[model samples]
Structures are given as C-alpha cells and as structure tokens.
Target: MGTYFIVREIQKDQETGEVRDGEIHFTDSNPYAIAYAEESIANRVIDLLREGTSLNNIREMLQNRHIR
Candidate 1:
C-alpha cells in the first residue's frame, strides 16, 4: 500500500454551525478526516496538495502554535 498525506481546510462545526476562532485539529487516528479526505481525493474534487500545502509554497497558515 502507498502512503497518503491528506489536507483538509479547517471547517466550522457541522452541527452547531459555530466557527471556532482557532485552528482546527484532528489526530492521525481521526477517521472522519481520513475517510472524507480519501473520498474527496478519489473523486478528484480537490488536489492532493490543496491550499499549496507543500514544501515549496512558503506561505504561513496560522500565527499561533498548535493548540494540542
């Protein structure tokens, strides 16, 4: 099997419709991000490296350190 790196844009709360004011995080074990990212990748709905999340882009995503 091959390795895959998934990138998802942090989204607001699905049920509450509340947009958290900080970075969103999901651990490596989070199944939801994995399953969703995988399906989206397979469907070609998003590029594997969306948001230019690669070694070369050099754009900073957030100012604060990771919460966890």
Candidate 2:
C-alpha cells in the first residue's frame, strides 16, 4: 500500500475565529482526497507564480504532483 496523507475539513467559530474541537474526515480512497490534493498543488503553483518562477517549470512540477 502507498502512504497517503489524510485531509479533512474543519469548522471554525465565526466570532472567535477558532478551530472547532473536532474534525470530519472523509472516507479513505475518496475522490475528495484527489481533489484536495490537486487543490493543494494548485495553491503551491500560485505561490511559485508569485515568486516569479517560470510558468513552464511550474507546469512541469504540477505534472509530477509532488508538492515540496
């Protein structure tokens, strides 16, 4: 089996802006996991874009799907 990082959505309090005590984890092997991973990669691409990284390089890295 391959190692997979678990991603979860957590609710926060509106007034205090504090994370709630518990989190909800979607099922393992869920398509949501893939979407979350892709979103994370996209965010990193945005960061690199802000840093003036070349678009071709960023696209290559995104193609690999290995953030960091």
Candidate 3:
C-alpha cells in the first residue's frame, strides 16, 4: 500500500457559531503512524495559531511545506 495524507479545513464551530480550525490526517499501511501524525500536526497547528499566526499565513506555510 501507499501513504495517504488528508487535510480538512474546519469552517466553523457548530454550537458556538464560530470559525473552526483546520486538521491534518496521515494514514499508511501501519496504523501506528496515523495516530501520532494526526495529533501531532493538529496540536502543532493549534500552537501556531495561538502564537498569533494568521490563517492565511498558515495556509501558505502548509502549502509551501507540502508539494503534493
């Protein structure tokens, strides 16, 4: 099998009616990699956002970070 990367952009919070955050998911033939990669990338993005990084900037950074 091959590795797969899934990226999801959250548009808004359902209950609070606020804009939601983005998420990244990684999956492979090995299940262990998915768990670690998913949470790690998510938390990292959250930290970056909390540190005052704009969403657009984050998008740009991620786009630059990933070629495919």
The TM-scores, one per candidate, come to 0.20, 0.38, 0.40
| lDDT tens readout by residue for model 2, 1-68 | 33332334557989999995343333336544322334455456556655667767765775776565
Candidates 1 and 3 compared: the better one by TM-score is 3
- Cα TM-score of candidate 1: 0.20
Global lDDT for candidate 3? 0.52
Note the Cα lDDT for every prediction shown: 0.34, 0.51, 0.52
Candidate 3: Cα lDDT at 13: 73
Best by TM-score: 3
**Segments in model 3 whose C-alpha atoms lie over 4 Å from true places:** 1-37, 66-68
- lDDT by residue for model 1 over 23-62, one digit each (tens)? 3332334443432223323233233233334423222211
**Residue-pair clashes per candidate:** 0, 0, 0
**Candidate 1 at residue 33, lDDT?**
46
TM-score for predicted model 2 compared with the true structure: 0.38
Per-model C-alpha RMSD? 12.3, 8.7, 8.1
Could you tell me how far off, in angstroms, the CA of residue 37 lies in candidate 3 after the best superposition?
A: 8.5
Order of candidates by TM-score, top first?
3, 2, 1
- Stretches off by above 4 angstroms in model 2 are 1-37
